[model samples]
Target: MSDCILEMRGITKEFPGVKALNNVHLRVKAGEIHALCGENGAGKSTLMKVLSGVYPHGTYTGDILYQGNVCRFKNIKQSEEAGIVIIHQELALVPQLSIAENLFLGNEQAQKGVIDWRKTKLETLELMKKVGLAEPADTLVSQIGVGKQQLVEIAKALAKKVRLLILDEPTAALNEDDSENLLNLLLELKKQGITSIMISHKLNEITKIADSITVLRDGQTIETLDVQGGELTENRIIKGMVGRELQNRYPERHAEIGEVIFEVKEWNVHHPLRPDRKVVSDANLSVRKGEIAGIAGLMGSGRTELAMSIFGKSYGKNISGTLIKDGRQLNIRHAGDAIQNGIVYVTEDRKGNGLILMDNIKGNITLSKLNKVASGLVMDERREKHEAERFRRKLNIKTPDIYQTTGNLSGGNQQKVMLSKWIFAEPDILILDEPTRGIDVGAKYEIYGIINQLAEEGKAVIIISSELPELLGMCDRIYTMCEGELTAEFSKEDASQETLMKYMTNRIKKGGEAYADTGANG
Candidate 1:
């Protein structure tokens, strides 16, 4: 008689040195959107993995009841057969495959073990229509944008006849418009009687869509709030997740800004693959010592491209620019050169381009500056450990030890390790791209404090973020980019979300001209 479609009771999962989940309980109603919220390492993902059979039944002590029947799944396939499917944050689609091919990868529409092309295409179209994806079945997944890719993922889940869908950080990488569309699609799915459990760090989205919310903290369930009961609020959720009153989302900082120490003038870059297409155009910006500068833009507005191209021409082809540091022209050709000249870029793609996940924390922390922990071509293990342990404590990394593999650490801890690596390089100018992209509010506040500390130490810091509130809160000055052009600049006092968004979406036309006239120097 209970309306719960899925119930996980007394789940306890442990690893070699960490108890990832302890007595965690979750219940998803028949056709409601349930949100799972917590800090970085709070066992949200681990519990979901157990439910989807990634950890398997025997690997953990738990009881899973699906539709009032005891379910013991041995693997992902068994769970899928039982109508439970999990779509991970890192999408599982093959880039080279067509949309139809990726959708029916393992669960193919076939006759005698061979694919039925006509039937496959027809089903693919139907599935796409359900998720509001209008892409052709023959179109390569690589050819579509990230928004379209997410739709493909959903359509794939639909193909499996998913009764209970679990999504991990679904909108973490999506832009605003794409995130809205995806959230709307989930509502549509709910109307069709599909139950969903969403694990996300975006509290606003949770408050907007989740019917029931379960908060987890440090491997244990804290509390669950009902949206219909008016018990769901961002502040209340934050209090549960962090076990305290957050007070202020951004830390207080007193900046002692000095003269401009770094400047890029008349910068232009062409796309790496398409030489005729420009990615960054006539961009001019400057950062002073003890100042946190921010670049605001929509996705594909060339924010990341500008940052990467400046960090020793690591991106784009036919790059033409003048880099000035402390009133002197500097020529930098590569990342090593940029580092040598006291400039470092912490990449937005932490997993793909920043950290070596398989390596230990100590290895990743000392990777960027091995010589600092080296004794004449030999690595000093003691020094490396000492350095890594220092940063771990300084950043409150929440790891068992520095010897733990980076892959096992949570998203926030992995990001801290990435920052520690670049911080160890002893750079005078630090550029962070999407520094808090997938991080929770507590983790984001900690990162903001770290940036404040860097500014206090007289290091010029530049942040590139899609979240306007983050930039408004943390930056001493903000720059808006639109269509590969630096459109406008505003001091901290003048920068508001509305104004920044207007420039970000290219609503104001004269801002670009004003920026060209004054530049960052003005």
Candidate 2:
């Protein structure tokens, strides 16, 4: 018997003005963790969709052999029946449903069109235990954190008797601890003889867990490398994914930092839902013109809360803050006021809160400031197209034209569009939260270059990132946040990953002084 459990030959898929996949091939051995690596829009997700029946059998020309038999699946149901299941980046669980209800949504434990609640709960518990999830079966999906919710998804897959499991960017939204747990679970599942395929942009995680890796670029197969051979490294994988050796992960920048351009003093924000709970407290930070400042903290450390609250109180309740721009205190009441005062915030949740996915690139790019491309109450389509085209070229957004739908573009392109929108607003202070999250190394390099260019243009940029190395590489000054308080501050010359992490995890007591003085007014 052959060891190969799955093989895709000569797969070709296309759409209007786009050849998403062209003559792609993939082979996955039985009971081995196979990783699919590529830059954004490199046909990774499209190939998976074709195999899982999202595009159906006839929509694409391909040969799929599963378990020594040719499989022509016309829908996801047929694929699932054949023991092939795909979990998307955006989880499919219903937030309002209970754990048990979500697990057996389509495949219920029932008799005579009536559900057996007792049997469902018992089986749910068994599945939960298998995935190391300790939550009760009656618990609502929304009640659990993202990590537990991911486990619920896996338990659901196990319930279907899944033989070949596929996951797309599983840990993109998870923190360090949750990501570690999920990767460990995958290793455990491999021990149980389950075949898995994981698609991820995280090169570090891929190198750690993948038994074999297949690199794809520009909608075609590059090469498959054996991890056991002891020759495969992150640099080698990068060569295959981007078709060249990237000498530096971060682009070089000549920072010309000037006098203080923006300052936030004694900023405090309470939770909107729970008014008594403070989300950000006694924060003091300053950014100089032509400087890139960074906020380094672990997940749930109030970095985003602080940025949002500072940006016209978009988040939190009972916000009290002093915003000084160029030595003048401003009273900003809303997002519009912030924009008018030349302050813009680029949200981390780009898909959820940043862009209108349905709108085209031209609309999204010019959406932030309509006055730039409008006369009185009427929009100038020609001027709008000109501005959008200019930014698309400026950012090197990979697309056929400015009329393409924003949702159809890749993750990296979507982020560029979001940046273009804010840049069009002509902001003096830019707060970018997770600017390079979920993007490949090539895209990250481009984004860092863009940030450098913005700073070169004399904008005061504040970055909030989960990746410590990114902050260390790009920021001229870095501040550490812990439990809603500014714990410490360090200059780029004095900061390292180890030093930043120490202060990030340092818990600050209430009414206590910061570990280090920020050297700014409070």
Candidate 3:
């Protein structure tokens, strides 16, 4: 195209034991949002790194043509200087710093070795406004929500005068409104002549904002399509990514509902920091003896908070709940107390809260229930190894041995370890939040199989998912929360994307009342 702004031709990248990228070709027109689509480990990140100069010219074989001339980027700094900025999937803001400070961290507004505080704040406010952030620049990053933090990231990129912005899963953690806002911001940026490259698993989002789409699979470029004139659909994009038509994004599971085993009534959770604020309001939910109940919502809709608060109040303050297991109410005020009562929650944040990353699989699995293998103060190391080995096989965790550190494993394998840890606790009620997020399709299938098996085993499984397909496919019943309230309840037969999203955004009414759901269920 005559409007081509950036191009990579014959790009090849290799690791010692793997070919990360294979002659991948990509072209982007000026002021167009180019979506990079791929499954995890499909060389998308590797290609971006190479383009952004994380891999220097000597390390990768490629020719980058920006604005028609050939160029080689030596480092991230050089790339930024050339008006290319990348915001990583994991946000890069200093939590303790003010928004202004983070926006101009290394590139401070200084004159004669003196920082210009007034000018910095003024510029930060303008930049934040450009990205649709309404907050004051002096606000600390930690004080704001994740969606706002994402805006700050954009503002930082804008501060660098980025013409080509690369976003890796920018809206993965965003709620419906926030995600919409981010997409609208991208559209606005496009109008301002800023070209964007977005890499995401949310195909619907890609369809809405991207002007063109490129598919990368198994370290190779498949095809690129112009998304204008309704040329791109989710099914087509998925076919390109997975290399085959996925009959359904959500794998089907036949449900065999049984008697109710786990029940919560009138549960209430207060904000962890601001005790006066309710995070989860009065809510009532139940999971059957052999059924999967799904809690669906946008980010910050109290889905994860509900799971965490109910799990020994591990996440929220001023928590009060009546947990009824087998028609008997039990007090579960601590993590150990919940575990003893046959309840376990596998957190969404596996790397941070779920696993002892530096430790081996055996150590992490047994760490949850050391009392089972403990003789007095010391655990019987032999028995622990035997138990870990048993689950490693049962769960199909692809580790060389139970002794290998968990951090070295893939995201999917690490998730398996987290599950193994909870399963060892022998819980009757198991809560899984974002269980299959950021994993490959094959891994997602394995995780789904495990969930199905758990349901078959008569565990009361409560699955909280960002992906609607997962909830629709695996859940016997679905509960959708918006803001801080449960707005809709649907039997699996009645649920659809539209209905679920209606509740998820607080658009639907439940029990003749419209309310923002604070996840209070007992």
Candidate 4:
């Protein structure tokens, strides 16, 4: 009998003009945690899709072996029936549905073609206990937080009698405590003899839990290292993913900050749903020409809400603020008004708010600034193509051509397209919210380089990020926020992780908030 629980050989998947995966191979031992590591668009997810029957049997060229026997899976249901279940990054749970309903969505507790409500709730409660979920089975999935939602997803998998589990970027959006809890649950699962395959960009978690790590780059398998063989390190894994030794995770840059060009003063925003609740309180900040300023905050500190409200009141109600551009005060009413005033906000929710995913790359890139390629209300095809192709090369976006669908592109490339859309709008002040979220280290370095280039061009830049290290590495100045209030400010020379955390957690500290000396600083 073979020692491996699963084996995939010679897997090759192709899309229109794109070979997403080529001759990729993977092996998973029973009751061991396997990790798949790669740069964006390097075929990690594609390979998992093949294994989970998302691509079906005839759509791809591959051989799958489960339990020492060749198996042909026709769909996700077939794979699930054989004890294989995959939990995607963007969860598949229905928000309004109860936990019991979500857990046994397709596979329900039924008798005579009618769902048995009592049996479904009972089994759901048991599954929830196993996954460390405390919510009642009758609780609505939407009423719970994201961290809890993750647990519900695991419980759903457990209900399916999943033997080999696949999780893609499981902790990408989770906070520190929630992430630790999920990792611990995985460890507990491993001890219980449930094999797992996790795809993640977080090397720390992978090193801690993964028994074996497989590295893939550009649709080809590079190497797989056994953790038990020796002590594995993130640096070693990074080399295999990028095929080079990266001395610094962030690109080096020198600051050439000039006079402030954009500023917000006495900014306040109220919760849209809760009229009396203030989400952002008396916020004041500014950004100068050639300066990269950063906002460091924990989740729900109102950083995103502030940025959106200031960018034409797209987020909150009862908005009160003063916007100054080039020392002149202006009233910006909507997104178009903000853009006309030479300001653009690149949303953190890139897929939902940033890009038209169904549109081609060329169309999405040029959508923000169509006036540049228009002649009397008609778009010029040649001009649009030329502009799109220019950004594709300048940003080094990995795509076959500009005509490819934006939705099909990887996270990194999609982010690049979003940046291109705003850059083409010729904005003087650019606000980036989690610009490097969900991308690999190599792609992050590339994005940092682009931000540096933008700064070098004398554009004012504002960055909001969850990672403290990224802010320390890229920003010339950093401001910490806590509970919808600006708590502290630190120059690059004085800022450290320790100091930032102090302010980040002290929401009620006396005299915490600090505004810029001039009316024009972000």
Better model by lDDT: candidate 2 vs candidate 4: 2
Q: Where in model 2 is the C-alpha error above 4 Å?
A: 509-512, 515-522
TM match of model 3 to true structure:
0.87
- lDDT (0-100) at residue 338 of candidate 2? 99
Worst 10 residues of 3 by lDDT: 513-522
User: Candidate 2 lDDT, tens digit per residue, 1-522?
Assistant: 999999999999998889989999999999999999999999999999999999999988979999989989999999999999999998999999999999999999999999999999999999999999888899999999888899899999999999999999999888888999999999999999999999998988998999999999999999999986686779999999899999999888998888999989999999999999998998988999999999999888999999999888999999997999999999999999999999999999999999999999999999999999999999999999999999999999999999999999999999999999999999999999999998888888899999999999999999999989899999988889988988888888878999888888987631257634544322
RMSD of 2: 1.8
> What C-alpha lDDT do the candidate models reach, one value each?
0.92, 0.93, 0.86, 0.91
List pairs with backbone clashes in candidate 1.
Answer: none
Candidate 4 per-residue C-alpha lDDT over 334-447 given as tens digits, one digit per residue, 9 for 90 to 100: 999999999999998889999999999999999987899999899999999999999999999989899999999999999999999999999999999999988898899999
Cα shift from native, residue 476, model 3 (Å): 1.0
TM-score for all models, in order of appearance: 0.98, 0.97, 0.87, 0.97
| Ranking of models by lDDT | 2, 1, 4, 3
Greater-lDDT candidate between 1 and 2: 2
- lDDT tens digits by residue: candidate 1, 1-522: 999998889999999978999999888899999999999999999999999889988899979999999998889999999899999999999999999999999999999988899999999999999999887899999999888899999999999999999999999988899999999999999999999999999999989988999999999999888987866669999999999999999999999999999999999999999999999988888999999999999999999999999999999999998999999999999989999999999999999999999999999999999999999999998998899999999998978899899999988889999999999999999999999989888999989999999999999999999888899999988998989988888888877999888888883544437464434454
**What does the lDDT read for residue 87 in candidate 4?**
95
Residue 510 of candidate 3: its Cα lDDT? 68
